[model samples]
Target chain A: MTYCVGMMLEKGLVFMSDTRTNAGLDNISTFQKMKIWEQPGQGVITLMSAGNLATTQAVVSILDERTKAHDERDPSILAVPSMFQAARLIAKTLKDVIANHAQVGQRADSAFNATLILGGQIAGGPPRLFLIYPEGNFIEAGADTPFFQIGEMMYGRPILVRAYEPGLSFEEAMRLLLVSFDSTIKANLTVGLPLDFHFYETDSLEQGKTGRISADDPYFLAISQGWGEALKSALDQQPTFEF
Target chain B: MTYCVGMMLEKGLVFMSDTRTNAGLDNISTFQKMKIWEQPGQGVITLMSAGNLATTQAVVSILDERTKAHDERDPSILAVPSMFQAARLIAKTLKDVIANHAQVGQRADSAFNATLILGGQIAGGPPRLFLIYPEGNFIEAGADTPFFQIGEMMYGRPILVRAYEPGLSFEEAMRLLLVSFDSTIKANLTVGLPLDFHFYETDSLEQGKTGRISADDPYFLAISQGWGEALKSALDQQPTFEF
Candidate 1:
């Protein structure tokens, strides 16, 4: 299982994904789930995937291979004119990969499905974020729904719902995501560190910033411990129930 | 859907349950999920259920009727001599009810299955808590696993895992539970207001303090709002990530 969240805020886009993947309790491994396609001043796109490891890797391989092909026969995600078209390309690739795998004796209902979060900016357009489903359909983040979460989402969702603001700064958004991810890691073993984080500023048309947070990262440790203590202190301050 | 939690603490036991039940988003109603059977000085058993509303209601009705029946030929839950025995009685009754309903043409896999949290104390024995499955088998909460939650549990679980301590006072436990429930309610539409809470002191062997917290209740409102602000404040206080 994986846990990933993408937010579309006034400042830009924030993306985070856990690296833990497991076939079973005893077969756990660390694998990066975030992929970036950059065209310097032209455009920048980031994709984070969750679901079957094999399927996600296959989708990424197909997209990466297309970008390096000598022939201009196929359009790569990096060459897509807009973020919408980039998302469409990734969705189509994902569906074709899953369908091809299913046709070769594997049941489609098996765990070979993958969902993705695609977000970035094209030089002339504003930033955008989308959640691409395994069925190849996708939905863009709108004013009413400013964020999208996939895989092991429920454990970390309350904080996002309660604290998310439309105009948060990049720093504040990262802090919020850290707290949310910490809560999930504490409550569930399937989702572990290190975590991948990306920050994209609207219209920059360049790879903004990216980093990895591991189990012993000082800032993450502080947030995890600080949030727990703060919650207990808050509970202590609340009025007790009267019988 | 429902959300219910039962915890066995050093001081005693704490049980909290939401009263919302819904077959679909359009069809929502309030229904109590907590049931108590107390012989005052002899024993006190509390049952909180989640899952199929009809199955839970049927199980409760059967137990209630047996306690009221004057005939000695049928053994009632009230006659159970120990907390373990009481749990067995409830589990057996629950399995029987589900089986009986299945025999009437409904698929066994239908929503007619219920999961329950049973906690209480009997004179001359230590307090106990059990999670009864639909198949009539149950597992008691122990030192390693001190609490049990059923139905829409993920949203509220992280807080419980972070803050729960066996030595917490009854008031502290209730506060913890309120924060957990508030998290659930904020994140999910299926778990709603008018929560039922019960507290049983060890060796008291009597019905404990119980109450309901509705949507407009002042203390509940305070907890709900205060927790959100507290979380945001905590996030602000955390050290910002350096790129």
Candidate 2:
């Protein structure tokens, strides 16, 4: 199990991913789910993955090879005309990688699949986010459902739905996100920390803010404490019945 | 889909269930999910159901009939020796009911089933709670896992895992329960309200506190709002990018 959320905000984009994977409770392991592709000023692409590790890594390898080839050849992250096309390239690569694996006479459990969220900005266009399904097709994030979550998503859904709005403060957005992640980690053992947190500005044109929050991080502690107290206070506020 | 939670607290028990059932997003109806059997001063039992509505209703009907037949034939809740025996009776009834419907051609899907949480106490024993599975067997709530939830459980699970202590205040417990439900409702379209909320005290000698919370309930509104702000505040307190 994993929990990864990518929020497309008016400021830019907030992408966070947990780094825990397990085949079963006994065979747990930590694997970073965020991949960074950067040519510094020319273009920056970040991909957060959830689902099968092997499948995701294979897809990542293919994308890496493509970008490396782009330097010698043309059409790179540095060269892609639009974020839409970059999403397409990712879908095609993931599909080919998955299809190749399927051609062989074997398959892992229902888990031998992966979901990826690709969010980035080419120098000119608006920063964009796309949720790439296991199949080659993908959907661009809409204003209505501006957030895309993959992996153990339920525990965090309410917080996201309630606090999410287009013009939320970066502080507000990030705080709500941590609560979302906190809710998930406590409930499901499969999702764990040091989480990868990235904040991108709408037109910064620069790479943007990056933060790492571990299980012992200060911000996490405050949020967890506040959330606990908040529940107590909220409960006190509820009208009670005579027993 | 449904969202029902039953907790065994030192003070007694808390049971809550939403009142929405749906075949799909388009076909939704309000069907209450909480059933109470109050033989006031002797025992007070509450059963909350989730899963297939037909199956749940059938299980409730069977339980009800056992009590109705207590005259010259046999006694059910009214005749049970203890709360444990009551749980056993419910378990056996569930098993018998499912077994009876298993052979029927018209009820192919009935076998898929409903899960129920039976919480209450009979005088002379501690308030006991059982999570009745589709199978005849059931397990009592433990200190480690003091709460049981059925149907659309994932969203609310995270919240419960963190806040559920046997000693949480009744009001606090209710708040925690609602946040948990809020998450489930936001994520899945299946669970909704007018909710049935009950808080039963341990050894309170039969009478318990119960309330019906509507969608417009004020306390509920405060918890939802405060929780959202609390989450955002928590996120804001985290440290960001560094040199």
TM-scores, all models, native as reference:
0.96, 0.88
Local distance difference test, each candidate? 0.90, 0.79
Report residue B52 deviation for candidate 2 (angstroms).
1.1
Ten-residue stretch with the least lDDT total in model 1 chain B? B72-81
lDDT of 1 by residue, B1-243 (tens): 889999999999999999999989999999999998898888888999999988999999989988887884266876787889989889999999998888897466666899999999888889999999999999999999999999999999988988899999888887889899989998899999999988999999888888898899888888888888877776776778666
The TM-score measured for candidate 2 stands at 0.88
Off by over 4 Å in 1: A108-110, B108-110
Task: Pick the lDDT winner.
Answer: 1
The fnat scores of all predictions, in order, read: 0.78, 0.43
Off by over 4 Å in 2: A70-78, A107-109, A168-172, A204-206, A230-243, B70-75, B99-111, B158-172, B205-207, B218-243
Q: What is the TM-score of chain A in candidate 2?
A: 0.92
The sequence of per-residue lDDT tens digits that candidate 2 reaches over residues B67-176 is: 78746436576567787888888877777767777776675755457788998888777788889988878998887778888988987786677567888778777778
Q: Which CAPRI level is candidate 2?
A: acceptable
